[model samples]
Target: MKQQKGFTLIELAIVLAIIGIILGAILKGQELINNAKAKRLLNDVKGWATLEYTFYDRYGRFAGDGDGDGLIDAGAFATSQANFGANYIPPTSALLTPTTAYQNSDFDAPVATLEAAQLLPAAQNAPQRRTNVTNAFNGITYPASVYIDNVGTFNVIAVKNIPCFAAKVIDSNIDGSIGANVGYVREIDNTGALTGNNTWSCDANNNEQQLVSLVYFFDKRPN
Candidate 1:
């Protein structure tokens, strides 16, 4: 009978080391992938923000009317183009002229008229409503005085405006501790997805929403 052959201890050790290296490489690759995904998501959010601003500029409000009305009518003032434009310009009669309130196709001209003003109060005073554009995600739910904190590692996620008497995010918190009320939650992936336990703070004193971090992924290496 032929003598049985077996791997020497050194050969076995080498094989185990190779396996460990392969596992490490795979983990590193996954980390890189996740990092890239996070960055992409961040970029996507920024792009969305741009679109939102543009929407307000072109149409006089945010993307959609929460009330599902054809026009950005009453109770839907936060995104009104007329209101935001009013806030942008100085008190010049041409810009501030009551007749200038209406520009977007969705709204009728001479929006300054009492009747027009009555149509969309929120849209008219959007600027005075809230400074930061409130995220009106279709199904995202959050508590009051919360906001998405984009600082430190992307470990913490999302934020919200403090619950206020009015339906606005800025006036939501009066104490200015809106930064401390940040919460952390897992990312949402499904329809009507909800993120819980996420940090809700101002972005590094920038007074802007970051929603992401710089070192997206750490210690990544080639597989």
Candidate 2:
């Protein structure tokens, strides 16, 4: 058999350099994507809060607070109306009172509630639990949600289903620091607790990659 000559140092170095460049580009691309997701998640929370507040500004009430209890709630506190009447008032619509029923047919009434009040254009009812923006990971599309939640002692509109990494970035960006239970933007575990409590999903663990919720206070803080 004829002996084969080994590759020159320059050729080997060129191959290694190309590999480094490809790896660097991939890492940079992933970082950029993560940043983009964080930004979109931030915008999602702000947009939902704005929509609810805009409804408040226009109708003096939240989109899903059928009882006008100053909260956007579901289940026992969710709107009980299959369809609102023409005379429905957003702020004080006693016609649609709260009742107990998990996953009521009208569970996703926030969007419809807004449309019924002429805030949003009347269209096909949105799928259950969809907010202003959706985040997709592992090929599963996650629609972030807005509802009444608390941070410490203050109630706020919580935006849910944000990736932990993205939530951290968002919290830092909003509050100028990262934290679990303090600041304008705070983290909430899947259990709806003010503190993450080192839960696998919102805190440290294998499930840390799981999604969590973030609450934006709109600068509403207790004195």
Candidate 3:
């Protein structure tokens, strides 16, 4: 009988183990990248909030709602009046609209006012300001805005990101779980109350989940 040249089972097991190790490393690397992106999103939200507060402190009024009119003052800025208004009230439901073909309207008047007052950089004017920033994890353009709520009691700045992406943001900033009082809220419609639904809320097991696209309002708004 010819001598068998087949390798022993030990060799095969070693190769399989090496492959598993490589796969695990790759998965962990991807998870770290995602977490970094989520943190950046949270930072962006905080930055905008800080800018709003700075504007308020300098001018004694919200950026867009100049003159304390509870509406975006067009004359205060160099943008169109239509692009600046109390359209993003109730922050939970306000959808960011495109001001032109290339840019989404993001606090056009308020940001512009900040620019005009020299509180914000002149380059940070509307039509070119940070309207929609890309989410590194999901490749989605999260639209941001600064506006006063309907009651005129709060100055709200918000970003609309998909539920999963938003969840990452909330988890990093607030509680790690998507439970009630998570410092963020989700709503089905622009006019409805933000309730924890199955789609956006984690199940009783506390697993991260997703729902329809939802807006994530920052808690640092000035009231």
Candidate 4:
């Protein structure tokens, strides 16, 4: 009998099966990688915030001068830039012009306009001053509900990649207040006003703030 020159049907089928299995495993691994990346980004953001808080507690101000000046500016919370390892930058577009007075409306207007612009950028290479998503990860999308609490005029927000699920400005002392779950918030003015205390809590478990204040990045696996 002549030697077989081609793979048998059974062999071919087996090979295909093996290939399918390998592909499936690779896809699964990719998903895990994505999830891990998202988690890392989130953790990094948390750490950065913690660092800022620690630094402020020690130095009475945030690190990294937002302005070009070298000296650390006092009470300049909004302007200072915080690096979270990943290259996620905020928007540069001006909102109602810069003013000396602290205005919550300033943050609100830009967030609306900036988010609109970001979700729908004018160009592919457009310069971004603020980003709710991480550029390091693929398929990372920031939902509309991502925002900072604005109670007591706490406009300075600290969040990462999150969906449009709103945010909560919870005061530890507050009792059954309806304002804690107002969806994506832009600022949390002051924790003292709502709870008769000065402790602000941003909980991600709430339906209103489902994805807000979370630095998550995800990648979709092939089906």
Residue 208's C-alpha lDDT in candidate 4? 36
Model 3 scores a C-alpha lDDT of 0.44
In lDDT terms, which candidate is top? 2
Give the residue spans of candidate 4 off by over 4 A: 1-8, 62-135, 138-150, 155-223
* Model 1 ranges off by over 4 Å: 66-223
Per-candidate TM-score against the hidden true structure: 0.36, 0.67, 0.57, 0.36
Among the numbered candidates, top TM-score falls to 2
What C-alpha root-mean-square deviation, in Å, does candidate 2 show against the real structure?
6.9
Clashing pairs in 3: 93-190
Q: What does candidate 2's lDDT look like per residue over 1-223, in tens digits?
A: 9999999999999999999999999999988987887787666556656776787777665666665656554322122122222222232233234441213233345555655665555544332223222343321111123333452333355555657887777677777887766677766554445563322244556454577665666626432
The lDDT values for all models are: 0.30, 0.52, 0.44, 0.32
TM-score of 3: 0.57
lDDT of 3 by residue, 31-140 (tens): 78767766776666566567756756765655555345443342211222234433322221111121211122344455545555565455333233443333443322
Ranking by lDDT: 2, 3, 4, 1
TM-score of 4: 0.36
